[model samples]
Structure formats: structure tokens, C-alpha cells
Target: MPRSRMLEYDGAAWHEDCFLCSGCRKPIGSEAFVPDNRRFYCLACYEQQVAPRCSHCRKALTKGGLTYRGEVWHRDCFLCCGCGSALAGQTFTSQGERPYCVRCFSSLYAKKCAACNTPITGFGDGKYVSFEERQWHQPCFKCSRCSVSLIGSGFFPDRDQILCADCNSDD
Candidate 1:
């Protein structure tokens, strides 16, 4: 026969009343008391728990759902404010009130052009076989040889390279 162990506190010995599984309140051996949620439970009931997963990444959601703009989204499924793109599987997070996609967000760091000293709105390979190197907006720089603005012109000529109507007429 096995001897029953009495519950003991710092300086007092006591016996538990109504031994039950803390999770399901089912009867259990006096020795099976497992503390949980401020109550004791048998091992079997504690092992049957389930946790929620995030809808966006399908990972366990440790915290909970986030409410943004009146919509509930998993922390990972939120969209960037700048590009309106989904933000799943990304390591970076924006602390701003609105999020931004990687590309649109990087525009914040773009520097102004050195030649014209204007904000760089766009970029392209500035290579004309005949002319020296130059960085220009589509409308800013004319063909070096023609001096005509290359706004709507289908083509613009450099020293030897033929240019557009504006460039062709300038010289």
C-alpha cells in the first residue's frame, strides 16, 4: 500500500479539499494536483489546450489581433501607407501612424541632383555615346549639340546621335 503525502506549508501541515483537475474539474488522485490559473489541474486536461494562429502568416499569435482603420488584421498582414501594399513576411516595421512599402519608403532618403540642384524625381542611365556625362530630368536637359528641350520629342540627338524635333531645330 502507498502512503499518502500531506500538503505542507512553511510551518503548518494541511490537507486539500475535493481534489479535482483545475482545467475540467474532474476527480483526480490527491497527488495529481498541478497549479495553473491559480488552480490545480491533472496533467491530462492541461495537455489538451489549443492556441490561435495569425491569419496573415499562419503563425501562432502570441498577442492578439490588431485593429487598424476599423479593420481587424493580423499584425503581419497590415498594408503600407505609401504604396498600399501588404506587409507580410517582412522583417522591417514602421513606427509611423501609417506604414510604407520598401520602395515608396526609401524615396524619403533620395538626394537632390548635383547638376541642376533639384529634387531627384526619377532616374535613368545618363549615357549618350557622343556627349559627356550628365544627369537630367526628362524635360530639363536638352541635347548638348541641339540645345532644344526634349519634352515630347520621340528622340534627341547628341554630338553624332540624332535627337528629337526640339533638339533638331535648336542648332
Candidate 2:
């Protein structure tokens, strides 16, 4: 009769030779293993067959990772589609299922302010005013003649220029 050492796991005693990995059917002799659905697997087999894969690189995510839009990704794989920068712990936006860093997103997609002709990124609590399909930053929304703020007051649109009511009367 042959004798072998035994190990106990999850209240079940398993002979070392009999403790085989469900994936490769190799003996799991004291090495780290993963248990799933009452089946045992070695680290290699578990990583190959059970670990979540990165959506971008299609590699097994054996450690810390990220999830976006219900898809999984490794930390190094969650990159901005625009500039190819890492987006972990950083502000980002998505367009057509791809991720982009804030700076890249603003440059590529944000609306341009009509008065200043600069991108009006709606970040950092910055406010803007939109009028007749044109947009402007709060500070840029002013009368062209007197430079008076037109917010919360009536103004006149005069040939691609905004004029305060007082300034419009003088024109």
C-alpha cells in the first residue's frame, strides 16, 4: 500500500497526489491555488481560464484592474484613446465607447466660445452662456461697445456684436 500526505481545505481532506487542478489536471502540491465552484485550479490555470481579461489588451487581469462601461481593463490598459495616456485616478470622458483625458477631450470635442474663440470646457465649475446657437464664457459675455456684463440683463445683438441697452441707444 502507498502512503501520501494529506491537506485539508474547505473542510475536505485531500491527498496531495489527488489534489489536482481542474483546468490542467495537474497535481496541486502545496502551491497556491484558486477554488471555484468546489473545483481547484493552479495559479497558471486559474489565470488562463478564470481571471478577468482586459478589454483593451485582451490579457488576463490577475491583480488590481479597472472597469468602465461594464468592461474590464488592467490599470496599464485603461488609456486615453486620444492621447494614449494612462487614465487611472484622472478625469476622463468617453466618446463612442473610447476613453479620453480631460485635456484631450476638451481640445477635440468641447465647444468653442463665440466671443473669445476658445474651447469652452465645462469643467472646474466654469459657467457659460448660450445664445442663438452661440456660446460664451461668463466673463466673455459682455457688450462690445461698453464692455458691460450682459448677464441677467437685456442686451441687443447688433451685426455680430452684443451691445448693452444704454450703448445700443447711442449707436
Candidate 3:
């Protein structure tokens, strides 16, 4: 065959017409192509055959997507397991393989604060106090009689009430 126009790719020289898409079997003719294991493919063919699929929607991911626990997901398909809300760019947590928004995760899984009866998230600077198998937000861990903070002070635990030394002596 006489070589009029040729292309050199991956150390092989071929006539321009012979360099074709592996999937569509059409002439590549210098349009953008992807080479996978010595096989050349056009963008459309590569997307269909080689691109990773979203774990939730099972669709090829041609644009931005996320990988969690070795599973792929489109941004829109990454939803909270507990509330069915979009989780992209938001604070989220996972229990096993399912993802949850922060609000839902806290409501469903966080330990209940003994004093205020709200979820103790244990996130950020919001520290907690634990005593007698019960937990409370740091601010809520106060003396039952004086309403004073018991964070660093010695206290007495009588039934459900936590009394500071002064309050305990007065009682």
C-alpha cells in the first residue's frame, strides 16, 4: 500500500485511514482518541466501554464523581442513607456502606446527652463528660443543687443528682 498520509502512535506507523476506533470501527482521522492496552478508542466508545460506572445509578461517569470505600458514585447519586438528601460538599458520615448527612447521622446514631437529652455528636470543640455510665455535654455537666459547672471540681453522685462538695455538705 502506498503511504500518502500516515500516523505514528505507540511506536507503530499506519495510514491515516487505518487508525480507527476499536469500538465503533471508524476512522479516527486525528480526532481525540484514548488508547487502552494498545487498542485505540474514540471518546464516546471509551466512555461506554472503559469508564467507571456509578455504584448507585450504574451509569458511566464521564465527569466529576466520587469514590468511597472502593465504590463509585455520581455527585447527584451520593445521597444520605437515613434522610435521602444530597451529600455532595456537605458534612457526612457512614455506617457500614451507607452514607448519612451529619444531621441524620447524629439523630440516628449519636449518644444521647444525659442532662439535656439531645444527641451528643462529639464533633468539633463540643466536648462531653462521662460518669457512672452516663454522658453529658461539658456545659450540661453541672452541680444539680448549685447549677455551677462541675468540669474540674470534685462532685458526689447521689442517685441521679450530681452534687458539688459544698452542695453535698449542705444537704
The models' CA-based lDDT, in order, is 0.51, 0.89, 0.88
- Cα deviation in Å at residue 104, candidate 1? 1.4
TM-score of each: 0.25, 0.83, 0.82
State the lDDT of candidate 3 residue by residue for 19-127, as single tens digits. Answer: 8999999999889998888899999998899888999999988779998889889999999999899999987888777889888988989888888888888666469
Report the alpha-carbon TM-score of model 2 versus the true structure: 0.83
Cα lDDT of model 1 overall? 0.51
Ranking of models by lDDT:
2, 3, 1
Residue-level error in angstroms, candidate 2, position 30:
2.2
Clashes of 1: 7
Instruction: Give the Å shift of residue 86 in candidate 3.
Output: 0.8
List runs of model 1 lying over 4 Å from the truth: 1-76, 91-95, 108-171
Q: What is the Cα root-mean-square deviation between model 1 and the actual structure? A: 12.7
Best by lDDT: 2
